[model samples]
Target: MRPARGSPDTRSGVRWGMRLTLNIDASPLRRWHLLLIERLETISGLDLSISLPETDLPDQSGLGPLFRVEGLLHNLRSDGLFARASRAEVTVATDRPMDESDLVLDLGDGRASVPGRRWTLHVDGDAGEGALVAALLAGRMPLVELKEGGALIAAGRPGTEYGRILLATLDDVLSRVVTLIVSAVSGGRLRVPTLPPTEAEQAAAVPQAGIAQTVVKAGFSKAIELVYRSCFHAPHWRVGWRRLDGPDLFALKRHPDSGWTDLPDDGTRFYADPFPILHEGKLTLFVEDFVHATGKGIISAVEFGPDGPLGAPEPVFEQPGHLSYPFVFARDGEVWMIPESCSAGRVDLFRATAFPGGWVKEATLIEGVTASDATLVERDGLWWLFATVRDGGGSFSDALHLWSAPDFRGPWTAHPRNPVLIDIASARPAGQMVIRDGELLRPVQDCRQGYGKALGIARVTRLDGEGFAQEVETIIEAGGPLWPGRRLHSLNSAGGFEFIDGSAMVRRNPLARRKPAAVLASS
Candidate 1:
């Protein structure tokens, strides 16, 4: 053991060079390392210089050698350059003489071998994906490991650029192969990581009177951010009252083809929700018009016109009861909608008697349950509705429930496996799903840390089975005042533009030059 020395005075990497044999205390941890390596390699475009031990170490349970690796990341801000003799390379030489004089990484794809001692790396996802191990081997890759608190385990020297990124803590080599293997073998199913259980820490009270809202640089671009003003008693939402006060216009972010600047203020305030549909010849938006009052509800309508919201919102229809989450779906020329009839304890539908407005109730799909934010998608001749129901608290609580109807208008059935997906953070629907290169991508509000605070993306790998198989990635977080006070996340699509509701936009994009609805006309 060459005394660990990568301090300011003397910079030396933890010298463990020899045919090294490493073991993950738990199998899942091994799998996790392999996955991160592959992903980071793909995303950062750097070939990793780390690898797991060649042989498997059964999960005997206990925080293995990884614990030490974790501690190093938290404590060391800079890994300092290596020995002046070799500043560019972080070499790992084995004590035992090896038959092959090469650096070999076993990613199970095969072993990625290079006729060299060390390799340079950056976090990337373009290392090419097949199986994590196989891809690594195919690419002759090493891994960057993830330890406690998602810290990286780097065993070599660090350059200035690498050091700055290490601010997010990229210390270890990644193993992208093993984790993907587990995912494939399990049919792409996802669950809370099966790591060793952790103790619950007492949550610090939501900070004192005025905790200055600080900026948090995120590794991913966030979709939503929220700021809890502790000035009033119990906050506004909890008291069931949200005021529609603003500049009274929604300055659009990710505005559409209409060349619109903002939504109208003629008493129409857009809520952070989006509905996507193929109406006539192009994709269209049916955004939320939320009325903030004692008996407030969301309006179901689309923004029309060539430029943008042509005018104040045109009247769509009035549900006798509260209505929100009015999602529009068009199939074979006829338009249909699934509005939040949660208060009525069911998901009901209506056919549009006219385009842009005028919808008549057609059928009641699911009955005898509570559901809000109901979004509908038709795949393989099956109508699937993604929605949230009451599991505990009355507000947006519990996992999202999936129900299917043979026809958009009929008695629907819930997926045999109810709560098809859980995790408040990624399970709740932020808006509508986007079809990118044939992939069904849903923008999810990650409430795991808190409600509507962080944003995640769930790519549905499988929805044919009893339940869905998804791959989730936390993609964004609220930065700070540069936008608004946080809480900006939702996926919206209208015409040719895919609108991402960010914190700064006050009103929906409603211009008439290109779109059908006039922003301030016919109010």
Candidate 2:
């Protein structure tokens, strides 16, 4: 008993559906697509169940299902770029999917190839559903398989205009299928993704926007819950200089509009944490040089007068593991430096027995605590330290913690503001504090981009015997009209400010624009 030709069947459908039968041999990049599927459900408000083929992926290796879904999910959920879907459904065509809910698209020709997928995607019910299905089976037109979330509506109902939205929903699904099919390759692939980075985020990630600025946009894509994530293996640290770089010294000269100029050196990144004190007469700088390519970082000393890059980055402390965020200072005629030992579970103090490099471990300030970007301050005869600690499941670089002691040694007390600050945009310790007028001003890092990509200022609003409150004053972002390309914001000091600029590509020179990112190679 089929319905009359002109009679519309009204039905509001909501179901958890869809499946993925991946035909790939490796999982490093494949498993990621699984996560992409789950995200589609969240964004679309559909209870979607996305699955992969029944092959055994490595449990510990990159192939395993992990939290890859989580880290990306937040970015999507936190931002609302689309309206909720009222009614929509998806059916996938794949090989050996573990679940029964997944199957071939109802309109596609029963084959499993790219061309068939494309044709199925472009099909419209009015033109000829049969032709669409036949084209899908023949593999002439493509069947676009996508994991997506989108705005949709229940159609052909008795009295609802919002009843059924066919064209829009179909268009969105078609786009997703195209994007999903082509996301796996390199070169000339016109991808119609279910979701892509909103234009705003793309602007932020693009280079040379300016100094001290940032924007975060959530991407749209389906994702899966695999309880898997990538763990970064701490890399080794190396110290060296680019022979092609210009001199490091500056003449207090400022850029006409851009602000300042210093020769570019691609070695390690540092802020003005101060290592070798120039207080005795000569100028010395202590900084943590983080080597980007190797993922390792270290601490070193540099001496400079009017010229530049005093000497071949004098060796001070080198290690197989990380030794950075060095907060160097002079105490009672001894030079002490506190490098980021958060990895070693303690903050060790090294007293420089000799002038620039020679030093010995004099004490341990804190133990069993995770800290990084450690910077210290002394006022009213009390020593206070600042660093960012790892929050239960967030980036350690985003949370700031504080500890104080009568001296820089044991028995330190957690500041009443244990998490002296919680805003990731400006919490982690940056460069050393500089004396401003009469007040002490500290430079803080604003990691709006998952790393130190912006410089933030914190003014001491209250202090003395009563304690203190840090008031965030302002932020300087990368790629201002003057300074561009993810640059300007550094870790600590600038010269009078000094910070290892992360926004700028290594191959760039102040006089030169940072190289543009290579064009996308899609298939």
Candidate 3:
């Protein structure tokens, strides 16, 4: 079939300094085409010409060799037996020889051409509405190749979340295509790195069917518990501390048998996110005091002695929206805080105008991001900010993004690879990072079962402009008699004391028992 006429040149500011052609089937112009075109347009120096099967032919015989894309639009209409057979045909066609410079991106579901020569990819969906959604979500595409004998070559497991999986797969496909085209034109082999499986995929191998079944069977019990708790029990958090002699924060486990001394509360409110700081040879613990009536949290602090807290936690800072995760640190001879204010859609900085009582807004480090637990660290002459931001829609504890700046106050630039880490096991920052023996150790929330079900330690392997990486070293669960709860989330330390908080059950007050009626009393 004669190729159709070329579309208007949308090429603006070419990136790769080469001309390329994409010959896609005219009948199946799809959403994937638009995505591919949009991404390619971002690259400068490369002049792109999208040619359909009905477009007029150009005299390419004299151009030595041309970079081309083909065989991405078949099986769009066929289905059942015919569709399967057509897929097989498309796979076979991918192995055909072309100009060494010609790059073929085969996304069909069949045998793939040899790797290192031709690029092939596969998206796990049928060619219809499902396929369209998959194409749209694909931010990076995964590479797939079939050997001469139909052996598949790929890394990592498939993701459970369809949106994340599709986006990553599509992103990989486009990235690989760009690498191939750029290398072919520049006479340099730019190899695309092997991508790890998405967080959903890495976590999918664990079976949750039995757990889900149990939850369903216990629905009545859970409903009754919920009703009772709502009517009587309010969430109350207390701070537990262990004396640290020489920065062996992990030694807090040794006193597992010692019971926790509850930080006093008025029963109308609860306290959490305990962060202790030492100033002028005195220890002051900061917490998120959440009032049940107001349904909002405010920053509060209390003095701690060698035995326990000196008095009640007094309010230090309060904002219009809900505030939690009072991540405080001492820098430049002043106290600073970066609390989680996701409700306000910004992460703001607060400086103590008066120690432990008065705090004023210093600056808004990051705006327009629904960030939680904005932890800051000064490393290698740069300030690094770690937070889990909710982008679009998903769990807030799964994706970790990083930003670095020369100064803490202004001009923060996001890491080149934002959302650098995406594992529910250790993505959310539970508390401030501690440096031990010149090594950075971060406290992460293990949300595999639920938010803050447990606490984990991740040792930083790499953190720079290129990327961010970490390995979970230790996991601390809520157990061992001292702290009895199903959730253990925050961890912090100051002076000779380390603080932790967790969940606890609250029962109905016995003092509020009803009195006998007036007639019975008189009798």
Leading candidate by lDDT = 3
Rank the candidate models, highest TM-score first: 3, 2, 1
- List where candidate 2 sits over 4 angstroms from the true fold: 1-258, 263-276, 290-294, 463-468, 480-482, 491-500, 506-523
Predicted model with the maximum TM-score: 3
1-523 in candidate 1: lDDT tens per residue? Answer: 3432222111111122222112221122232343333333332112234433344444332222222333343453332211011212323222323223232333322233333342222222222222222322122212222221232222111111121122221221121123322222222323431111111101211221111111112111121222121211111110001112221012222212232233333322334355656677744456555553234555644444554443454447676676666677777678877777777887788888877677887788877777867777777788788886653222353356788878777557776555554344456677667666678877676543334544566678878645575666335544332223334355555454444443322223234224532222101
TM-score, each model?
A: 0.47, 0.48, 0.62
The 10-residue segment of model 1 with minimum total lDDT is: 233-242
Error of 3 at 470 (Å): 1.1
Winner on TM-score (2 vs 3): 3
Which residue runs of candidate 1 sit more than 4 Å off their true CA positions? 1-190, 193-270, 276-278, 281-284, 293-295, 300-302, 392-395, 479-482, 502-523
lDDT score, residue 437, model 1? 67
Query: Where does candidate 3 stray beyond 4 Å?
Result: 1-225, 231-235, 250-259, 508-523
- Cα lDDT of candidate 3 equals 0.56
For candidate 3, lDDT tens digit of each residue in 1-523? 3222332222331223334443343123334344445455455454454433333323221211100100111111212111112221221122233342234333333242323333333333231222322333332222222211243332111111222222222332333333233323332221212323433334443422332332343344446656867655445555667776554435333234545555655556677899988887889999999876688899999999987788888999997889899988888999888889997888898899899868889899998888889999999899999998665444566657799999888689987555665555577898878777788889887665456666777788788886666766667776557666666778888777777877655444443234311110000
Clashes of each: 86, 68, 33
Supply candidate 2's per-residue lDDT for 269. 34
TM-score, structure 3 vs. true: 0.62
Error of model 1, residue 247, in angstroms: 30
TM-score of 2: 0.48
Look at candidate 2 and tell me the lDDT of residue 520. Answer: 12
